[model samples]
Target: MEQRKEITMSRLQRFLVVSLIAVFVATLAPAALAESYKFGASKPGGSWYPIGTVLQRLADKNYGDKVTVEIGGGTGNLLNVMSGKLSFGLASATSIQEALKGAKMFKGKVAQAKKVRVAAVLYPNYLFWLVWAKSDVTSYQQLKGKKVNVMPKRFSFQALNQQMLGALGIEYKDFSKVNYLGFNDAVAQMKDNHIDAYLGPGEENYAPIVQLATHAPIRILSFSKEDVAKMKAANPGVVPFTLDKTNYKQKNDVNTVQTFLLIITNEDVPAERVYKLTKTIYDNLGDFAGAVKAFERVKVANATGDMGAPRHAGMDQYLKEKGLLK
Candidate 1:
């Protein structure tokens, strides 16, 4: 009886030891093998945020344990990626062009901005000028001497505001009061009637504009044909875009200047990784569009348009495969 009892006790002890070893291996193994990819986007509730989320989900689902993504600010993201602080990010064509040409925001910093290429032309962003419907401001030219909320310094929106205003022969001092507020702050100020005008680029279905329209009558001011031509002539990155009537609550079509938002990465990133990321985004376009209505127009074939820089080799490869590129 004693010998039988000893045999059972020894077998139970060995089983517990084996179970502990297996658990430890299972817990630590993935950490050692997993790879991560970072993508920078704008703040939450912004268009870039949802796009980043879609990319993250696709990477997670397709790459499994191999890759991940981190989303952050727009222009700030470009700086980070260029400095090797991030793997990839989203940027506007205008800003990217400035960076490449060492113009405006990129003056004396161009050396830090080379070899960046497009991953995709994500979507079109309209330069919006939201104003109270009661206001007499029907066009960009009429906003002269009126209070305006231009974006703050270091923000890409701010740079764009300055460039567009310059193209129209307007200056900061020309406005009665120019406040340097951010997107949320600008929306709040507009709601409170603290400012007469706020100019910036955003997705077509921006929530703040819709919410404001519900309470107060608002108008999306349009650019004149001459002004649009001047803007396009001055800044090749600026493109003429028209917002359909339904996009705004006013039920009328509005013409405006726009900049294309694009996914960008340093050319130094490995081709395989870029290929994987591009492939994942294309494979899951439906999922992205369903998640965010703003992404409804995104297509793999349209990934190369309105780009200010060359296409990344990896993305180029995928586009060639899809017959999107020659």
Candidate 2:
């Protein structure tokens, strides 16, 4: 009996040692599997920033600190994704098409376009032509000979502004002074009357416009049929949209043009990781929609919509499991 008891104690000690080793390896497994991915988003104070932040938070929750979000412009996002500088980025569908076509700001980078792929289609971004309500500059044509902020150079909004303005026979030279600024700086300049107009594109109730309006009433320039036709002629991606007074109270609905926003990924990202990333976002979409009003439109049905870029295989697999794709 004494010998049997001693043998049992020895077995117990071995069992405990093996269990501890198993636990230690389990703890380190996640860290071993974690691969860092860089995510690019729009500048601070813009809608894309918050959207990207929410995604980053979700990724951190699901995969630890394997994903990092960085500030990037629309055009820059596409370029960086192509160059493998970013694993993924938020970009407009129009800009993706422009990159693929080597058009507009993407003139001369067509070869790199093949590296970009669509991860998800997020929402629509409306082109906002904002001027102080009391200012005399109410029309796009009236922006001529006036100091204006056209966003930063090579920005997707700047490209859109140039395209639309080009259709109307307007150019940066036509403005008394053209300032290339980001969202916050443009809003600040507009508030101080340093700029007569600010041409940029963003989701409805974009934060910068909301902040600018609190200082002084601002008006969103409407697009006429002729204007829409001209813009569409310049870029087929331009679509007519009616901006209602949900966010900004206007007496009447404002007519404008809009483009879809998408999440783009580099072709080299692993299919399994992309699948997990898509699952993370799709599973916690409520958190995203809660953070950004624009994200409310993100749905499984629309997540895989054509955004002028090839769909990532990982995203496709997730959509297929949801019965969205064959």
Question: Which candidate wins on lDDT?
Answer: 2
Q: Compose the digit string of candidate 1's lDDT tens values, residues 135-160.
A: 99888888998999876665567778
Model 2 over residues 1-326: C-alpha lDDT tens digits?
A: 99999999999999999999999999998777777888888777777787778877777777774667888888888889988899888887778767878886677988889788888777788898888888887788898899989888757888788878989899889989999999889887888888888788856667788888788887888888988888888877778998886656665678889888888888898987788777877888788878787777776787755667788999999999999999
Output the lDDT of residue 133, model 1: 83
Clashes of each: 1, 0
Model 1 misplaced regions, further than 4 Å: 1-34, 65-72
- lDDT (C-alpha) at residue 197 in model 2: 86
Candidate 2 lDDT at 173 equals 93
Per-candidate TM vs. native?
Answer: 0.83, 0.89
